[model samples]
Target chain A: MSTIDVNGTAVEVDEEGYLVDLGSWTPEIGTALAKGDDCELTDNHWEVINFLREYYEEYQIAPAVRVLTKAIGKKLGKDKGNSKYLYELFPYGPAKQACKYAGLPKPTGCV
Target chain B: MSDVKKFLYVNRKQPYGTIYALESLEVVLIGAAFEQDVSLAFVDDGVYQLTKGQDPSGIGMKNFSPTYTALGDYDINKIYVEKESLEARGLTIDDLQHLTWEDEDEDWAEKDSIRVVSASEMAEIMDQQDIVLSF
Candidate 1:
């Protein structure tokens, strides 16, 4: 376990940098997480991050990349749903990197 | 279809108080990528997994019951709930969450994923599977 400072408060995260307690997540923490990777959270990035948060709220499990892509196409738009679009937003891997910023555990079946 | 094997996941435990139910769901999601013909059987105490309004927050555990609703998006639509198990637990089909999938072959018509089956019918389903994974 490791800690990241969010607004002077230490937040516990796993070795993989995922939040140890999901409820501790906040938009500021998400921005801090993205900054650690030197990736800035733009409106585009926040869109996917917010989507992931809502997805987790309803399903209680982070979706695998394939499922996430298809679902994004349905809820967002086809133009923004493809892996190319998502990958461009998070070069490290859409489900992995985006889920990290969204404070969701690594997506199920990701590995 | 010749290359696709029929896989059956037999769940016989309660949703909580054990890890089997959660492990089974994870396996099913991972296995869905293989595009096999998959079916889930909820027998014995497993019937409790599908019951509606599961609140595990009180137990300090993640409430994963809602994750079952995502099964439809994974193309796993064949969910069989044992009639005997539900009756033994004093639950009816209405007590479970309603799950459905879109039928692409039928112009994307939404179809129910859960089917209540008798023990004998469930046995027949098991006999038809090429692979049976117990959880």
Candidate 2:
């Protein structure tokens, strides 16, 4: 486990940079974490982060890329629903990186 | 730690019933990061892992089978789907996902990822591996 400073408050993050305790998450922490990954939090990124957080709250797990893409397509417009666009926003992976910024657990099943 | 070795991940269990199939795939993805010679062999009930149009919502499970399509991006595209196993389960190549990858060395030509092989041929492949992890 490692710690990062968010508004001068130290918060623990896992080795993969996901929040150790999801309850410790905040917009400031998400911004700080995205900065560490060389990303800026645009409205597009928040759209994904918010969706992931809501999905995790409902399913108790972050979805893999396929499920995420399908759900995004059904809820958001198809224009913002494809993996290419999601990958463009996260670069690393939509499921992994976006969930990390959303303070969700690293999705375990085949991600 | 970059000592390149041949890794054969033998998957013989059915998907969804147990965690073995999904967990084995997790190892495959991590193994990809090591840049080793990785090949996956689907034998016995494991052939169901790649069956297309799997909807797990009725059982309250998330379908992660599509992750197999991205294996090529990790440079782990050599997959042997045993014909005997599929036949035993009354299936054919058409029942599975059409997985493909681009061959950059060959003018970016699209190539199939799954190769159907006989059980005996798979035995020969298993014999050639340096490290075999069967699930």
DockQ comparisons of all candidates to the true complex: 0.72, 0.11
lDDT of 1 by residue, B13-114 (tens): 998899999999999988987889999999999999999999998899878899999998889999999999999989999999999998868967999999
**How much lDDT does each candidate structure score?**
0.92, 0.85
Which portions of model 1 show Cα errors greater than 4 Å?
Answer: none
Per residue, candidate 2 scores C-alpha lDDT tens digits across B35-91 of 789999999999999998887899998687777776765577799999999999999
Candidate No. with top TM-score: 1
Quick one: best DockQ, which candidate? 1
TM-score of each: 0.93, 0.64
Lowest summed lDDT across 10 adjacent residues in model 1 chain B is found at B100-109
Q: Which stretches of candidate 2 lie over 4 Å from their true place?
A: A1-99, A102-111
Candidate 2 interface RMSD, angstroms, 1 decimal:
7.9
Q: Second chain only: TM-score per model?
A: 0.98, 0.95
The sequence of per-residue lDDT tens digits that candidate 2 reaches over residues A42-105 is: 9999999999988776545566676688668767978878999999999998989999999988
Give, for candidate 2 chain A, the lowest lDDT window spanning 10 residues.
A58-67
Compute the DockQ of candidate 1. Answer: 0.72
